[model samples]
Target: MTMATVRRISECFVKPLHDLSQEAKQPIYFSPFELLFLNANYSQKGLLFAKPTPTENQDFSISTFLDDLRGSLSATLDHFYPLAARLATRKQENPPSYVVYIDPENCQGVKFVHATVDATVEDIIASKDVHILVHSFFDLNNAINHDGHTLPLLSIQVTELTDGIFIGGSVNHLLADGTSFWHFMATWSEIFRSNERDGYSISRPPIFKKWVLEGSDPIINLPYTHEEQFIERFESPKVRERFFHFSSASVAKLKARANAECNTNKISSLQAVSAFIWKCVTRVRRQPNKSETICRLVVSNRSRVNPPMTENYFGNPIQSVSATTTVEELMVHGLGWAALKLHEAIKSHDDTAVKKLVESWLRNPIVYKLSGLFHPNLVHFGSSPRFDMYGCEFGLGKALAARSGFVNKADGKMTMYPGREGGGSMDVEVCLLPVYMMELERDEEFICALESN
Candidate 1:
């Protein structure tokens, strides 16, 4: 049972690109979350401050204690490197990396919370235990939280008062996919706690070369339009990471119905949720003579699908697979029709096919650009929260709630997880269109009532 008492900054780290000037800092694949948070503070890559767990023998200033902690932590690293990588502007082979600033003048030190380890877990797990509402480690005055955005603020408060340690960081989708980032955090914990070694044994090196994913395609020569310019300039449009909660039972019932109705194709809870969203959205949006509409559903390029992307594969391996239909077609056919469309996008394993499908828009500069801008009514639903929360003990009891932030963007996407042990029920806390959430919440209530029976 080991932990520190501090508020750590995840974003403040920066790795510098050699042979590339500061002008070329941003990479072409910049998304809305990356553009905003990165721009918020380039001077300090990220922020971190910690207070020593008060000891019976002695009390010390936060600054003095942090110095002791930093020395101990830094001693184990292979070499200090910046956490921020993937600059579109810098086309280079070698680069310098950076960690959060340590200058006392750079930011304020961590403030002490009144509670001690003496309190019960339930009592200390209270939101008031951590200073989430106050000044953010990564400049809250300059930052903003939206009802929509893929990159939201996160904090891991490790209090000296108890064996528990807070574990989380606001993740902008651009930095690293869930797979890579979580692995990094978990390893960091192992090193800090083991006290046996500076870092972990048999650790794999991180690859910061994100753009290399595209390879040398002749497609780079393609032309673009002004509309595309706006999209690229604005960043990818997708769901903001606001909470969208549905009951465990409603999702299960919907999945059962979806399976029975679409016997031709097996649909998971994901497909059913997508169908539900499409019907609910199309109903309210269809004004008078609205023609065909497009809904971009983000599919995680994971092994669950055919020719799956390896769990270790990082970067934006995800692609937007579209479901297009006329207003009449969607309204008349109901969930079965939409489920069929969704089912196709997720099925079958073929790297060439997935690459081709993604490249169709990705190669087109205009579409790629506009896809980032006006992805009107974009819906994101996929597998995440990967049930990894249960493993992030850090000496604390299981987290009562675990969620990632989406920088307040638009075109809502939401992911739902298994409810309390994959019990034919689902545990959902994700971003969605508030309008749809209201309707979905009602249905969840009904499902809950039925399940209680």
Candidate 2:
């Protein structure tokens, strides 16, 4: 497949047009969960979409797209003020300290890039690997760093294509999780669509109190201070990222197959799809000798909290639920068995369980214990079909498609998001070792179960 040529048109830093008053400039402290992300420094995942065109533009002119986005983003920052703040490290005497501060004065501004591409959206979306399209068109990688010291946690690149435009953004994971991130995007879209100055008229405005999770005394006692010690080295055995589309009907079929003989409870679409993928990948890549393989599902805690947090509470309120089983058992058993294991893992956590887990992590300083980077037996699931990516309407129109820019997707990591033209359909992005991915692609059963893309 031939690649599109992308040329940079312009680049500049955009600061909030309005200044934050002294009362509004109070520094926000990191929670235990937020500290976990801040210490590890996860790269911001992004979503890209073709320019909207249904609604009437102020002038129906082309050149104002970038200007409008920049202006709207600047205005949006007034409500989401922390995005424009600097993460400053403060001296602390405690071990495994957590005194990182988001200083507003050093925010500076976010970087905005405008580029032109010699291709259409379909040219890239129709390809076998959509990750290539994401990498090529959305180019704000340099703006996001693994270190939390960087300011202006968000950056956007708007690429003008022959047929349409692509609006891509990169954010610092320490600043927000997937829910918080999407909330910001939706707000930006609403502001751009309505030409609003602030979020006063918006129904669900963001809540930025730093001590929202203050109920739990956040502290950690660990032997290691350097987070790198927990991360395995990234070496050879090249990895590849591939995307698979499962239509609403296809997902229903998988769910039916999973619950065919079960008398207890029926599995959900996410559980069924996750199980099928897990089984396929494990069967293709697991070694002949028996060993325990694990599947980790990322979970959000906003709705799970005792007094459920408001939809607009912004920060990293995310956790993971893992299901581990021996390779022989996982492969020998049917899809229902695998799906049951996943459902059980998810059911293990509730409001009280989540609170206890948070408190436990405060004392233990837990790090991911998965196998080394290239180990095919370890897989992690991310993003969620629940996030309505296709609903984003930025005055132009709704997003044609959506994607994630999860930098350093080592191997055996997958992200699932709601399919465009949403029904119950889903899009799963998988990164794996080339050979294993080839085996998965060749799996006749897996291919037959998917809807033609």
Winning model by TM-score: 2
Cand. 1 TM to true fold? 0.58
Each model's lDDT comes to: 0.41, 0.72
CA lDDT of 420 in candidate 1? 38
- Model 2: how far residue 378 lies from native, Å: 1.6
The 10-residue segment of model 2 with minimum total lDDT is 366-375
Residue 173 accuracy (lDDT) in model 2: 74
Residue 37 of model 1: what lDDT? 29
| Candidate 2 lDDT tens digits, 286-353 | 57648878888988887887788777888877888889988999888888899999998998878888
